[model samples]
Target: MASCTRKLYHVHGFDPRQHLEHYFSDKPDMVFEEDFLIFPIENLTKTFLEGHIRGDVLIDLSLGSMIHHLYAPSEFFKNIIILKVRDRCILELKRWLNTRTGAFEWGHATQLHINIEGKSAELQDKEGKVREAAQHVAKCDLDKQNIMDPVVLPPADCIISVFLLDCICKDQDDYVRYIRKFSELLKPGGHLILIGVINMTYFTVGKDKIHGFAYDQDLARKTVAAEGFVIDKCVTKKATGISDLVDHKGVLFIASHKEK
Candidate 1:
């Protein structure tokens, strides 16, 4: 007799519209990215303003339907290239890039960044900066040796990724392998900024649960270091455990550079 078997859940990732509605709601309390992801970016911006992280080409890796965090970097970088894995995300982002209709409200994120970094109170100016700086938005192939296959994306001087790889990568090895690919996009000594939830096994979008690789600070530190990345700094923010919107022990921010 054949045995009954249960299939494992695959993390194909979440829909951009549902994700936006759930996480980026009008109620500030419901907004997760604005609260958790923006501060680390503020710190990055402060360093850039002080002439630390320099670059003409800044590559944003697999950022799904969210462009608010790029606000601070836009002021420093000459060009910004956004790459994504899914077609739905690309369409959502393109809608905003083209005309701003049907786009998730990003003004709060902009305001948060401005409040933290004092970039500017003018919301339109901040959005305009990022919109203007985003030179290209195209699909990426993380499975390939050259992830940015078609464009031959100019070796980035700095690359930023947030809450991207963890969900898409099926296992810890997958996570580490993609980091290597992410590093390959950088020029010698180029910086890498990674932001994600610590030990997050899954996140919820609507009624569905999106699975992700589980990891901690030690794993993060060891993997990046093992890949020959010089760890510049690491930061963490404690989660309040107030909401089950996503189950994460905490949030971790990592900054490192490929050795020169």
Candidate 2:
């Protein structure tokens, strides 16, 4: 039986559409909308509303092709740069940004964001703002000194990474190493916003199960502090969705600023 068991798929082999459908679709049975979508947006909106996280350029390093978390940041930041690990993820994002055919629908997420902000703007207008703010989308490699390599990026005022580390990092050392890299991308006193699953070992994307770095809030807090970040806010939500797609105990959101 052990010999016949299939190995877990790598993060690079991710199918964007299938992953999106399983976790981000509009169907009633899908439970990730609350933990993955609404939770981050709400926390981000609140953090931005407090008026401390100011920046001209914001860098986003997230998993797959997610854009829901950018709606609020687009309103605050002048420029948004998205870095993806996989080519397919980059293509998927471009399809939506360019308004190409077969792009995944994000109207629900847009509406939710607008509703939370109590704004009366049209959904299309908000989406257009996101597209305009997101001026660049490029591929990145975590193993490199310069993640973008060849094309050096100016130090951003803020960086928002959602669920990417959990999917990519193999162990605590990898997590800390990547956190240091994230520090390198920011200017002094710049902010770092991270959203990830707590104590999650694995998550399913399509037919393949992918590894998730099993970590808790304490590790995240200590790691960030060790990397010269001053913790500003940390929030966690217990898993409410009764689904077996992922064995996540809960979701975590941390907002910190790099020390000068």
Candidate 3:
């Protein structure tokens, strides 16, 4: 199976601005509110905040925005390194992190995080925590044998990837190939948090429909297990209804670790 070409992804898919604005809002039409933010994101925040997992370096293989980690309990990981796939995504993140103009404001997401964690008004402080933890935003090439090339990174204590596997892959085998590649960054027994839209083949952005390899929970588990990870947690966010923005019946969150 072949991976989706990078040129296609850059041209039509993974628009950093649209991705940020659409999925990180509180509105019911926003998929984040209806499915993603409530279950998968909230579960992740609560689990990490509760001290269920501990780590030093958290490697982000998610090419999307860094808003997910902004809500997480920050004390566990001393630093975060986000490995991005596209240059535009990196620029978007850097713009926001540096507080530059034209960058989309993620304060709304931070506020939503505060409400979910039941914290008192301290949105800016939490934003700082995320920024502090994120020490690097480097470009990554899943096409490479070493995703982090020329500069090898120490195996990370935790690896988190959201909504990336399917889009970059052509089929189940292609997805597993990349999964195995990224897992190399994880220390043995380190945690892996992967979130994806379930049973989705393609998604729309503006006038274009970007393609993705559709997958379900069964294949998700089997593939990770084939890589020697033991699943510890699984959470699914069922879609309330259908929409053109995304085509998925549910979202799945998986927390697992390689066998030590």
Clashes of each: 0, 0, 0
On a 0 to 1 TM-score scale, where does candidate 3 land against the true structure?
Answer: 0.90
Q: What is the lDDT, from 0 to 100, of the residue 25 in candidate 1?
A: 51
Which candidate tops lDDT? 2
Residues 179-239, candidate 1: write the lDDT tens digits.
8988888999999988877887777765667766788889989989998799887888776
Error of 3 at 81 (Å): 0.1
- Per residue, candidate 3 scores C-alpha lDDT tens digits across 43-93 of 777778767577778887774665655458465776888888788788888
The models' CA-based lDDT, in order, is: 0.75, 0.88, 0.74
Residue range with the least summed lDDT across 10 consecutive positions in model 1 = 1-10
Candidate 2: list runs displaced more than 4 Å: 1-11
Q: For each candidate, give its TM-score against the true structure.
A: 0.89, 0.95, 0.90
24 in model 1: Cα distance from truth in Å? 2.9
